[model samples]
Target: MAPPQPKAVAKPAAAPAGGVQKAKLGKPRNYDLGNGVVRFSKTKMFHKKAKYKFVGKKNPKAEKAKKPTVVVKQIGGEKNGGTRTVLLRRRRSFYPTQDKITPRPHHKTFSKHVRRIRPNLTPGTVCILLAGRHAGKRVVLVGVLPSGLLLVTGPFVFNSCPLRRVPQRYVIGTSTSVDLGDFQLPAHLDDGYFKKNKKSAKRTVKRKTGEDIFATKKEKYVPSEQRKADQKLVDEAVIKAIGKRADKKTLRGYLKAAFGLRSSQFPHRLRF
Candidate 1:
């Protein structure tokens, strides 16, 4: 090897007039204290004045927040018999207009939009439990995500199920009323059995005299007294149905139709 070459030494950063090296100089800048951390003396102590005021005299209201407006509701029957009235909230305006302004009428009807009630179900509607354990179970439909179809099911009834399992008959009907009407007894029994037959259909009467009775003799005969009794009952029922207590204004045409009544004959019956 030739004569050993001397390595160049690095120059130290310059110290400012304040006798402190500026942090802008790139280096592992540190200070030496005997054992504890070196406490750098600050040239200026920065402080801020509080913006909050305790006592305001001239504009005391400005310091306090504005009180919120409230509307109270009145509940009870109105002048029109049983008519109901409610107080709607009035919108506040920052500035008054030249003409006395009133709020526009709201015409929102529920029929316009179909509401989504369940998570696993689609946006339009859900199935109602008409009967059974899982009958009324509804699933929620989550917003469509790219990964897969998002179905929110159950928590209780929102639980997910295969779409193929949904039944067409289980859908909700638009009709307000499901008129099942009257329930009829089974056809196996005679009409007389339904009529106040205190005896059981399977039970047979045994005579203590050891005499056998034919079906014809066993059958009860309809006497004139029975006919008269039945007619009286029918007349009373008809009268009570069309009585004043069954006020036409508060009831539908049930009573009127039962008594073979027409709208022209009883105009008051059609008021409701």
Candidate 2:
């Protein structure tokens, strides 16, 4: 501007010997080579090296392995019948005495605080069925099965209940009972025997005549002759036993009294 000073010429910055530009002091830029290779800046390279170096080390204390105590107990049937020994490993003591080394203290038994009175379901006892198809029906207890099931019958003449095995929980026993001395049953009498007889009785009788004379005639099957006679005797005995407590006015009245049912809870009105 002052007397036409010589026009200053700007010269381009020259690259370094390695053909790469030196980064500024405060700012750095990354260089990209072909094939996904990137030359990181100096700060980035320092941070990457420091990330993989294991500077801080920790030594954890080793844990001790605990050994479990073994216990043996006798289980199953009698001495020589079906008994066997069982081995049990106990990681922790379950018994109160074993957990705490304390002297044996006398405490009130469970019966003192809470009394659990189970129904007396002996043989020849009169009980009311509480569940199943025979529910609300009065049946006489015949005997007990080996598996603790109760064998009962409705004598077919009364509630039409046949000989059946029922769970003890399904029947509510009463104080009335008959003399079971003459009503002894077989030790292995089960539902299978009655089912077999029932199936046999249902077999169709073949007519010898070739004529279809009675094509529409259907005959009813009788399961057991001797068992029917015995059932009648048991029915008589049960009626006599229940006579003391029940009113013999009518069959329904007798059943209602025997089962201790109220007017609202009558067996005929209640649905299963």
Candidate 3:
């Protein structure tokens, strides 16, 4: 060999000004998280999984005491006349006990819950009316009615207060009582019996006229035959019952007369 020669090595080409730009290429096997779509992944593609510690709701069983405390209690009752010893497993809870507010009695049950009939008020007792169109009129109590009302009748022939219903609070009960003596009122009578029938609606709507809405009508409301029969039934029984009394005529006169106060006579001072 003549003379040793150095090996030539090729160097990288010089880049242009502002650096050379490379062609963009698509990334393979990569995807973004879907917004609640099918089989979506929470972690971003090629990203490390979050290292946050797992958290969950507290277990109710674990919150309870590990070992219940033994407690002694004394209970007394009619069956167990004396005190009895008992072992109770009392558990101390993590949360303090909270007091709850109680509510008042319900309105639905209030009516039935507070029902009480006056002992003084009884069937067939004579009472004096204190209110209504026939105020100061004396009537006989036929029977106890629904909703603590008194079913009374003025016998129609006397005070014109036909078989009617009045509240127990509106009348004063007298010592006088009527002896039905094997007589009883018809069972058909009830709260519904005293209710007036609703007027029938007109089939055709008539044109408006210049008549007063409350003007006096030519025809008057007449009691039906059934009402008349019921009235007669009640009155006849009452009349017959009165006739058997010792002071029948005096009692009739007292009922027929209207009650009123004289010049300075106090009603409270007078007895019924």
Query: 1-272, model 2: which lDDT tens digit per residue?
Result: 55877978999789989999987676334556758777886668778677546557668889989654444454656664544544465336555555656788888864355422255877777778888877888877887765457888875666688777888778777665655556567544754555543233233445897856445543576667766765676567666655554444554344543344676787565532
The lDDT per prediction is: 0.36, 0.65, 0.76
Taking all chains together, each candidate's TM-score versus the true structure is: 0.13, 0.37, 0.53
- Candidate 1, residues 1-272, lDDT tens digits: the string is 79989998988877778997766656322344547654342321111222234335355455677565664445566663443444354556545558787899977665444444333334322233333344444432212222222222122312322221223334332211111123221232232422454553344555665655322234464535643454344333323332334352332232112122355676244321
lDDT score, residue 31, model 2? Answer: 59
lDDT per residue for candidate 3 within 38-99, as digits (tens), equals: 33344652243433332454556656665634444556676765655444633355454787
Scored by lDDT, model 2 comes in at: 0.65
Ranking by lDDT: 3, 2, 1
- Model 1 spans > 4 angstroms off: 1-34, 40-64, 67-69, 73-272
Candidate 3 yields a Cα-based lDDT of: 0.76
Which candidate tops TM-score?
A: 3
Best by lDDT: 3
**C-alpha RMSD values across all candidates:** 29.7, 24.5, 29.9
| Error of model 2, residue 118, in angstroms | 4.6
